[model samples]
Target: MENESPDLQLQGLHYLTGAPVRIAIRQGRIAGVEPLNDPPASLRQLPWIGPGFVDLQINGYAGMDFNTLPIAPHTTSRLSRALWSEGVTSFFPTVITNSEDAILEAVSAIARECEEDEAAGSAVAGIHLEGPFISPEDGARGAHSRAYVRAPDWPLFQRWQEAARGRIKIVTVSPEWPEAEAFIRRCADSGVLVSIGHTAAAPDQIARAVAAGAAMSTHFGNGAHPVLPRHPNYLWEQLAADELWTCLIADGFHLPDSVLKVAMKVKGDKALLVSDAVMFSGMPAGTYESHIGGKVVLTPQGRLQMADQPQLLAGSVKMLPAGVSHLVKRGLCSLGEAWEMASVRPAKRVGLPFSAGLEAGAPADVLLIEWGDAGGDGSEPRIAGVYKNGVSVWP
Candidate 1:
């Protein structure tokens, strides 16, 4: 019924209270945004509004693994609908280290779907290829199959680009890999966002990569060997590299609260929140089998293994909204600050032009949330409703 409303009005939304505001939606696009007023009894009692969370890295959810199967044209659309229910109206379906055929097949499928229905696809903006060009070290490589790891080959990248039909938005690779700097330059020249991760790159190599055009660090603190003497590992180097935007899992399990705070401080608005949620994500906490990395045990504390040998994070069970909440709850940042990480920051990192916050003429992609009590130590916040392109897509 809400979707049927050609023109709908929402009042009483605080809009961070920097002056009162009213938002009007028409035909699934933001018709206008103006100062707030108590319109009528009919327009009252809607939840408070904010921008919808945009995740730049999501592997899979709802028992479907993106890397496990060659993504069919309909499969991405189905997953897009599923993501809408989770308050994500925009996401980049990340395909990690896998066979070349699988990568091309999956990318082709997603690109085809987006081409068919760009808006209804819930902002399938682009594809994130995490790797094949990365370190082969067991701990550093994490769950990626080492057999497929290789040096950055420009010709191979060109082939994958053709297969993807130019939908590859970002590529994460190890800076230390041979010819990586050159590849990073080529990627930047071609408008692909290049990120450094799954790496054991030396300080000089890290600097070189940053200079070359690697602008982000994927899941900064995770995917590394368990033991390290102290400062100056890949994590530290990435943090010190001021030019690189850093994305962190922030699901409490990936990085400690203190470490998360440090990362947030180091990167500031350059920090972005990513789910990295796997196929077992929306499933309940229990033992689950991952395709790349074998069996993993999930606990109430979130996923973990012995710290002595940090193998794989598999992926995150937390979604983008929850990850943003985690950042706020841990005192790492304020609610507005957290929201920026999930929405604007990632949009900028990937060079997306439509940074659709509550701006007039922007797409009417919005979220309404009921804030939880601040004093609660472990209480979870809630997403009351979500709208994509001015239409209520989830409740």
Candidate 2:
């Protein structure tokens, strides 16, 4: 072994195969790897090691709402460190529907945080604009404020993009508006990814949006009507379109086991797992007031809901790590496969280079997990350690 030896080395059973492997890191990136075919002379505690998870639709964490006014630059740095504890190394700080001024302010705040600190900057892959150009229908609008619901305005979006310093990678909108197709093309031409969400667009409208370069669906089973026609609904429409990559909030509350199973099978590698987590995530179980979802309650069952209407979910409280464990527990997918849905696949969709597992030249964004009775005990997989760029970043 060389001097300054990688900062650390983890020997563990492969997450999928359950075979021992040695992973080495150096200078915040994967430097080497070798199979440990035989047991070491003296063994130490080992856990499953894999690439860190990436969440494309995270809204906020630890009481920080991205849309909340007067956002501070330090908030992004704090949230990034907080998410590390949950096995997330990469995520988008999503800003949902809001007044144009509020949107620009929030973007500028987030941009300033990333622009100032390299570590904070790397954690924020891009900005996610989830609305202000979505359906006005009640159920379809989800928890986004109705007052802010309006048509798409390219000029206004350009201003927000300027404030975001061109870090606005994804935009979610409904294709129901007359200007939808053109707006999608404009966004795509500018190298931004457009997604459909909070929508009641017809099948033709959805197809047109896809034709105009809308590449994905945001939280497919959510931000829509509870009931739908058997055939031509937005859910089915997006599902059938191979051109559209779909994101699923697989935290159990957001999807039924049956639906999740079918969607995973159909989309195959294209399906991505997203937390869609709110500010209350990573917090204790209790009724908590939120800046966005007023009087939201965080239940012991891992469900975050409105206190006034227990039936309606106020975004998810489960982080991406829990979502991965839930899929494995429900027999929806294997540990390796489920983890990829939460990590590599999403990275690929966004054109980010990611390693399949620890490998030479790969960024040292990794997780050491103890797969403790996670399924039988109805508990989350315990994270033994989290590393970003080869450094222990988790408590």
Candidate 3:
């Protein structure tokens, strides 16, 4: 079916207040929002209006893998359209650590897809480069190949940026290297967000990275050594840095509830959620071969771990909706707060227009959610409808 006409009105319960509202749309943006005076017999009959999710770190969805060598044609476009049902209106296709040439090809293909496909062009906020410039240590490196890991190389990054048509908005780096501070400063100055992740950096180095404009932390508390010094570790340093926004993978398996609560409390609104999901996100639970980890298993419980060692996680199989559900289920945060962390907050961090959410004059990138059971039951939100730029795109 074709999308709804740009000029239209949608009636639903407001996501934050749970009050009925009528949202006016015109010319692909929200014209106004007004509260409904009449009391409905059943609020469950109406969907909840909220911002469409904006994922800052997702490698792929369903069967598509962004980091796979020779990314298939239209893979980016297919991924973009696939995410609408998942309530993701926008996302950053993540390209992880690989050989210089492989990285270039992957990004260039994504850039081409954006240039050629209108839907992809609008949905792909930017490219998230998750490394070659990171720690070479075993645990901190996560699944990134150690052979490709090296010191921060601006020239090499520049080549990737050029291939991506300047769409590399975020770069994850470890501040452990001697040249990291300068590299981070350069990326910040060039309008790229520098995120600290998969790191073995000391407290001083982490502080310096923040001083040099490291704006965010990637999947905080996951990609790191199993053990750390009791004090003066990178985790403590990032939490103390008020300017650093933290992104957590609230997939339940990634971080414990206690840690999630503390980070959310410390970072407050600056705390965000990211799926950091891989190609197996929407696939059935089964054993699969991954480019990052040779063999991995997707458990029915939604945990993705190495086949050989179930203790080690390969990547996440859940999406943003599941993360929001986990946070709410764990009583870590309220439904509204959890939604914003996965939606507007992440958009706000990236300076995207979708940050305005249901406000007037913001782009009408919205989700109509069936959240009737969310208040008490802690079930995942059912995305009944998704609208991008005021046009209904999902059933």
Candidate 4:
């Protein structure tokens, strides 16, 4: 990579605020932003300019599972291109619970992708380990195979981290285990973001994990027992805790609009969104044989579920942009607010700056969205351009 910072002038409305601006894109960063003015005839026009989404919980995409060993040679590039088409310029390719060999191979594959391609490397901010350290209970476990669930082992994780070349940025855990507090402490000490998820943990255990350094809740409202006591359960405990940030899967099905509203209200600036998507994401609505979750189906309702047992949801089939549109349709937030939840908030949670896009000195991980008559709330958005570090990755 040479010292090249090509320049581009983007004339459009800011996606979040809906204010017109002329932003100078240079060297993969936002070099300048100014209110739009009469420009020369050749200036390119777009309807929206915004930060590219930063997804933290994507397990897989485009029929390729991240946990499978010996991942397809072209899978990372394919997934990167697919996600960028949907306005995702940066993301964490999540590695969920699987066998030791499988998990190592998957992370190793991701590391190789980063080592191999600069664009792919810049796109993958880091790795998200959704864990073999989660709950083993049936419903709470979701689709994770119980055979692989185990207690958190620091030495084992160190080995995995080495395999990942220390690319593991986040790790989800269940604090119910006796060893969880120490595990969270170690993770936090090492600069890895610790997120609480997929647990049957009690209020005290939850408190202990926070005290030990758990910083966020993963897919907060889901990944738990279907039933719970009203007042002192994990949901309420997590909701009330001021120190913990809450990330939700607002894919319409994972949480109702009412719940999404409440979560956004309570978390305020602390709220973030994740896809929690699986390998089967982006496939058409139909049943497909899954090597990990047996038979899974993509429903007309835009949800992925266990084909044999439709009552339980498999992982999400959503991309972050669609999730943002759903939030806007539900009237839970304004376009700007919803976009913040989808893109800005999640990136900030992982220590990225709030001015990570559309601001001077910020990386040019940006999107140009052209909405139809419904204003991006009803239909799939039109992605006219995608820039990763000021270079248009979309044609």
* Number of the top-ranking candidate, with TM-score as the measure: 3
| Best model number under lDDT | 3
- Give lDDT: candidate 2, residue 261: 88
Please identify which of the two predictions, 1 or 3, would achieve the higher lDDT against the true structure.
3
> Cα lDDT of all candidates, in order?
0.77, 0.85, 0.92, 0.83
Residues 201-249, candidate 4: write the lDDT tens digits.
8999999999999989999889888888887888988888888999988
TM-scores for all candidates: the values are: 0.90, 0.94, 0.98, 0.94
RMSD of candidates 1 onward, in order: 3.2, 2.7, 1.2, 2.6
**lDDT by residue (tens digit), candidate 2, 41-131:** 5333457778889889778888776877888558888898889889998899999999999999998999999988766798888999999
TM-score-better candidate, 1 vs 3: 3
Query: Which of candidates 1 and 2 reaches a greater TM-score?
Result: 2
lDDT of 3 by residue, 51-159 (tens): 9999999998899989888998899999999999999999999999999999999999999999999899999999999998899998899889998998999998999
Least well predicted 10-residue stretch by lDDT in candidate 1: 304-313
- Where is model 2 poorest over a 10-residue stretch in terms of lDDT? 1-10
True-structure lDDT of candidate 3: 0.92
lDDT of 1 by residue, 93-202 (tens): 89888777877887877777877865524578788999999889977887789888889988888888898888888999899976999999999999999999888888
Q: Extract clashing residue pairs from model 2.
A: 6-25, 28-389
- Provide the global lDDT of candidate 4 against the true structure: 0.83
